[model samples]
Target: MSRHHDVVVIGGGQAGLAAGYHLRRLGLDFVILDARTTPGGAWQHTWGSLRLFSPAAYSSLPGRLMPPQEGQTYPDGAHVIEYLTEYEQRYGLPIVRPVAVDAVRRDGDRLRVESGSGEWRARAVISATGTWWRPFMPAVPGRAEFEGTQLHTVEYRRPADLAGQRVIVVGGGNSGAQIAADLAHETDLTWVTQRPPRFLADDIDGRALFDHATARRRALDEGRTDTGGVASLGDIVAVPPVREARDAGLLKAQPMFARMTATGVEWADGTTAEADTIVWCTGFRPALSHLAPLGLRGPRGHIPTAGTRALGEPRLHLLGYGDWTGPASATLIGVGRPARDAARAIAELLAEA
Candidate 1:
């Protein structure tokens, strides 16, 4: 079966919900297609111990603020899910769930979004399918040969399950640091990184990071020299837990392993460590496989865009991927601007058409 609208948004997560808020204000005919059976998008999949980088007020969508959790400085993943769920209900966004879109192809003057449940043709399409679904595991020799268990961030829930076991946590980003900290006292933990991990000042939070990104974006837009933005500050924000772990000397990181071994991993310096499990917090690529039929992706498997609108195909908008789509666009607070901009651009184009 097929339905039609002025716009069809794929992925009903934070990005899609943000887009829906703006689209509703513009009185556009649109429907959001979410693959998950429930709301909260990728937040539903985050580890139990994961916490947002900012306070509730600082992390919010276009229309509503996330309510603060009592006695909690930084809200956990469940709180984010609750906020996202309430946000969707408050706005009454039109959403159809559990419909996994397989391909988005050109259909004459419109775009055809083909999914298992049905098909939707729209003048414009918004792809907000975020990166959590595509966790990245780097290519290290003999990774498959390791006899112990291996898992990525997506599969990790809590550290209690792996308690009393020797485990290695790999990656230099916030996830690596946080996960390592979560497991510090529970496991015989060995934190490994490609390089030394950079921790932001204890005082800095998501609000500061968002400000830095916005400033950097404004500078570049005004043709000023690019300030490194968040990168200049650091990679890992010393969140309360991460800060505690660092202060307790639980986050000391080792250099990357030379290769995987049957027992564990071996380093170039002939150092070796045995482990029962390895948790990879490496990161993820954008979840854009549904857009493959459009043939608009660059060599990096990313759709090049001017703001959130696709460069080659202006009818399509890619939101909440990362800095390439918009500065800090992946964050709850950061996604609003790009979503608004994309919605406005689409409105203008559809009006012209």
Candidate 2:
């Protein structure tokens, strides 16, 4: 028999789990469909060297705080995965694992979530799929002809794998900076960004950024005219490793190369440099191919969302993509608020039904 739920939350990552936490509190019959076999969501696939930009206390979901191990401060990817596993057990969120949602189509008054395992019919659906599946790399001229070891930040795992290689780390975001710092210890790495990278103040971390986001969101909501300057999370946080690299004179960044050569890259000034590997730290797009059939995506391939709720499709809500869906919804500390609001919106819809 086909299963049915009042609400179906796709992608059991931080965003989906946050929504599930709220839905459970609202007494709604909902299920979270996770593509991964385990409970950590995309964190399970993250590189071993990856750690949260903030401390454990600041990077938590709605209900439970991520408890760190003895003497541990900023949690690594493994710590997050363990916490997520424990969070699911603590709340007993109704989650089905290893279920890849293929497509969501309108089924009369409800939406049908068709996955590889089975089908779930629900009146409301929340897409909390973070952008792990959609790692993007820009098209460098003649990139296809370059015969080199090219990997994105998603495929990269160990720093030792890049040891002794002339690597070009692309993107000015936090990931690129961190990865460059990691590789610099054992290898020759050239940092490449479209523009110069901005390093955040030493005191500022994810917590402070989230606080800023909250204040700005509040000001926008209240129609206040005095809007203050906000910082992007992409700005490099002077973490211990990054600082160490900076002190060692490894934080030097290079301008983006004009094009790719068979051996390496060509500079805008007609300079040539050879590299063994290219680690593109370019960001991701929303994993919204499943929702493509609904004809809701705009020109940029994003659904127009009004605070987590789809603009035209009230029955649909998108969480944890970026600022458009909600304030800082893409961060660990950022996803909770939007997920909570989405739950409330879906609860109101369910009540009307």
Return the top candidate by lDDT.
1
Candidate 2 ranges beyond 4 A from true positions: 226-229, 232-234
Please state every model's RMSD to the true fold in angstroms: 0.7, 1.3
How far off is model 1, as Cα RMSD? 0.7
Please provide TM-scores, in order, for all candidate models, with all chains considered together. Answer: 0.99, 0.97
**lDDT of each prediction vs. the true structure?**
0.94, 0.88
Q: Per-residue CA lDDT of candidate 2, range 56-142, in tens? A: 989999878888756556688889988889898899998898999999999999999998799999999999898999999998898
Which candidate comes out best when scored by TM-score?
A: 1
Shift of residue 108 alpha carbon in model 1, Å: 0.7
Error of 2 at 144 (Å): 0.5
Error of 2 at 287 (Å): 0.2
Model 1: how far residue 165 lies from native, Å: 0.7
Report the backbone clash tally of model 1: 0
TM-score of 2: 0.97
